[model samples]
Target: AHIITAVIGSGVLSLAWAIAQLGWAAGPAIMLLFALVIYYTSTLLAECYRSGDPETGKRHYTYMDAVRSYLPGTKVKLCGVIQYANLVGVAIGYTIAASISMRAVRRADCFHYHDVRGRSGKDSCKSSSNPYMIVFGVVQILFSQIPDFDQIWWLSIVAAVMSFTYSTIGLGLGIAQTVANGGIQGSLTGLSVGPGVTSMQKVWRSLQAFGNIAFAYSYSIILIEIQDTVKAPPPSEAKVMKKATGISVATTTVFYMLCGCMGYAAFGDAAPDNLLTGFGFYEPFWLLDVAN
Candidate 1:
C-alpha cells in the first residue's frame, strides 16, 4: 500500500493521464489488478505488523526479517546485494518516470510563458504533478547539451535496459497496476453517487475509496485472509491493526492530494517539465524569481 501509493501518489502525478491512456474499457481489469496489488501489499504490511513494533524487541514478517528468519546462510550477502539493486532500480525508475512528466509540464509552461503567455486556463497542464515529472525536466536540458554522439549511444542503452527490466513478470505486473489503476479521477468520475455534483458526493467517493483500502469493510476479509496466512496475528491485535492501517492510508492520501494540488498550482505544468534543469522549473515564474 505504502510503496504503490507512494509511487503513484508521489511518483506518478498524472494518475488521470495514465488511466486515460489505458482507456475506459480497461477499468474492470485495472481494478482486478488493484485487488491483487492490495492483497500483495496487505501481505507485506501484515508482515510489518508481525514484527513487533519497531520500538520493541520482537519481530514480525517484514521482508528482510522474513528472509533472515527463513533463509540464513552465507548467501545472506547475496540477499543484501539483491535488496540494494531493488532499491536502486526503484529510485532510478521513479526519478526517470517522474522526470518525464516534469519535462512535459515545463515544455507546456515554456510555451505558455514565452510563446503563448499564461492564458491556457482550463487547457493548462494535467494535474498529478508527481516527482517523476519533475526530474524529467532536468533530463530534457541534459539531453540537449550533451554531445550528440555519446548521448545518443547512452539513451539507446538506457532504453534497452529498461525494456529488459520490465520484461520480468513482477515488474510488468507492478508497473501496469500502478500506472492504470492508481485512482485520481476515479475518486471523482464513473463512481456511483447521488445525482448531480455535490460536496456530499465528493465526500462519499473519498470514503468509498477509503473503504476500498482502509476501514476493513468489503475488502477486509480477503485482505485479512492473506494476513492470517502471513503474520497470523491474534484476534486481540485487530484494534491496533485497524488504528495503524487507518493512519497510514489517510496520511498517504492527504499527502497525495496536497502534493498534486500545490505542485500544479505553483509550478503548474513546468514543475514536471523543467526537472532536468531543475532550475527551469521556476523560469516560468519570472515574477516570483524577481521578487525573491
Candidate 2:
C-alpha cells in the first residue's frame, strides 16, 4: 500500500528525474545511495524483529506503542494522530500521480497525453499506475484469505490494508484538488531547461529519480514499521522476527544498488523514464514484465 503511494506521488525513476537535472556522471553515485538506504531500512527492521521485547504482559506495547508512550499522552490521542497522518497521506497519493502525469505530458511537448480515464472518467491506468496496485493489493489481499479461518487477529490485518486504499483518488480532493493539482503542474510549468537534454541525460535522471524515491519510500516505510512495532510491541516471537527484517533490508539494499548499476550499464545513453524494466536486458535473472 505504501509503495503504491510512493509510485503514484513520485513516479518511477524519480532518482533519474532529479539526476537528469544534474548530468551524466551521477549514475554510479545514485545507485550507491539507493543501496545504503535499503541497508538502513532492512537493518532496523531486523533489529526490531530480533530484539524481542520480553513480553511485559502488555498488548499495546508493540514497536510503535513504545515510541508513543514517551510522549506522555492518552491512548486516544495517539490513535488520533495515526488516523490524521493517514488522511493527509491520502492527499499525497493523488498529488504524486498528478505530479508525474503533469511532468510526462509536458515532457512530451503536450503531444502524447493518453490520460488514464477510469470508469469515473477522471483518471486512467494506462501506465500500470493503479492497475498493478489494485490487482496486487486488493486481489491478493482477498486471495490471501481462503477459508476466513477461525482466527480473529489474522482477519483484522487483512481488513486494515484493504480499508486503507480508496479508488485511487485524493483525500480532500474535493476541497484541495486544486492545490493538489497545482503541486504537480510544475511538470510543465517552467521554461525549457535546455535544447533537448541527451537521452542518456534523461535515462540517468530517470534512474536517479527512481533511486531517490525508492530510497525515501523504503526508508520511511521501515522507520514507520519499526516505530510502530516498538511502540505497539510485536508478538512473543517479535524479537526473532527483528533479525529477519534486518536481513531482508540488508539484502534489499544490495539488490537495489545492483538494479541501479545494471540500469545505468544497459541504458547508458538511451534510458527511458521507466528504466528498471529496460535495464532487465542486462539482468537475465530478473523474471518480471515490469517494463511492459
Candidate 3:
C-alpha cells in the first residue's frame, strides 16, 4: 500500500500525452522499460537495507542513511541534496496539479449548468486557480502537522485506494471514448511532422515524453523510508521488500498501460496533457468531475 501510494501519482494523468508524442510502438515499450528499470533498482535498494546481514543488521532508517551506509563521504551529502530537491519539486508539481483538477471540477459543473440554462458558460467560467491552490496548501499544512506522518498506517491505505479509484475511472472512460470514436485512432509512428507541428517540435515532445514517463514511475527516493515501516522479518526484509515492490510495480503498470493506451486510442495525436481534466472526456461531466 505504501509503495502504491508513493508510485502512483498525479503524473499518471499526463501519460496519454506522453504516449501520443512517442506514438504506438515506442510509448508502451518505453513505459515497460521504465517499469523494469525501477523494479530492478528497487530490488537492489532493498538489498541495501541492511549493511552485512539480511536479517540481523543495522537498519537504514531513511534513503540518505542507506546512501551514507553504502556510499560514504561527499557522495552522501550530494545524494541528500539532490533527493530533497527532487522531492520539493515533486511537492510543487503535485500541488499545481491538484489545484488544476479542482478547477476542472468546478468548470465541468459550470458548463453543465450553463448548457442547461441555454447560456454561454465559456465566457463566465474563466477564473484563477489561486484559491484552489491555497486550499490545497492549507490542507497539506494540516497533514504535515501530524506526528510521524509516514507511519500513520491508514494514510497510505487511503491514498492507495484513491489512486486506484481515479485510475480505474480513467481507464473505463478511455475505453468508452475509444468505442464512441468508432475505432482506435492513433498511428504506429505517433504524431506526424507537418503543418502545425515541425520536426523540431516532434523531437522535443518525444524527449519530454521520456521525462514524463520517468516521472510517473518515480518513487525510489522514498523506498527506504517505506521499507522501514515493515516489521522485522522472518522471511527477510529484503525478500519482503522485493515481493512488495514487484506487486506494486505490476499493479501500477497495468493501470498505466490501460489508461495511457486507451486514451491514445481514443484521441490519437490530439490526446490532452491530462486525461481527466484536459477536457477530452467532457461528457459524462459528472464522472470526469469525480475522477478529477
Task: Give Cα-based local distance difference scores for all models.
Answer: 0.39, 0.38, 0.91
Q: Record all residue pairs in model 3 with backbone atoms less than 3 Å apart, i.e. clashing.
A: none
lDDT string for model 3 (1-292, tens) is 9999999998888899999999999999999999999999999999988889999989998898889988879999999899999999999999999999999998888888888888874778867889999999999999899888866789889999999889888888889989988999899989999999999999999999999999999999899888988889797789999999999999999989988999899899999999888888768888878888
TM for every model, in the order presented, reads 0.37, 0.41, 0.98
Residue range 219-264, candidate 2, lDDT tens digits: 3333333333344344443454445445544443343333333333
By TM-score, is 2 or 3 better? 3
Clashes of each: 25, 53, 0
Error of 1 at 26 (Å): 3.2
In candidate 1, what are the lDDT values of residues 1-292, reduced to their tens digit? Answer: 3222222222323322222223234422343454455545654555443444433435533345544654667566677677667656555655755555354545545545654553545434444555555556577567668674432435434543432332222222223333454432332133334556566755654444333232211232233322232233344334445544555444444433333333223332223322222332333343222211
Question: Candidate 1 — what's its lDDT?
Answer: 0.39
Q: Give the candidates in order of TM-score, highest first.
A: 3, 2, 1
Worst 10-residue lDDT window, candidate 1: 2-11
Which prediction has more favorable TM-score, 1 or 3? 3
In candidate 1, stretches whose alpha carbon ends up further than 4 angstroms from where it belongs are 1-22, 39-41, 48-57, 60-62, 74-82, 116-243, 246-292
Best of the candidates, lDDT: 3
In model 2, where do residues sit more than 4 Å from their true spots?
Answer: 1-27, 34-64, 74-194, 197-211, 214-242, 276-292
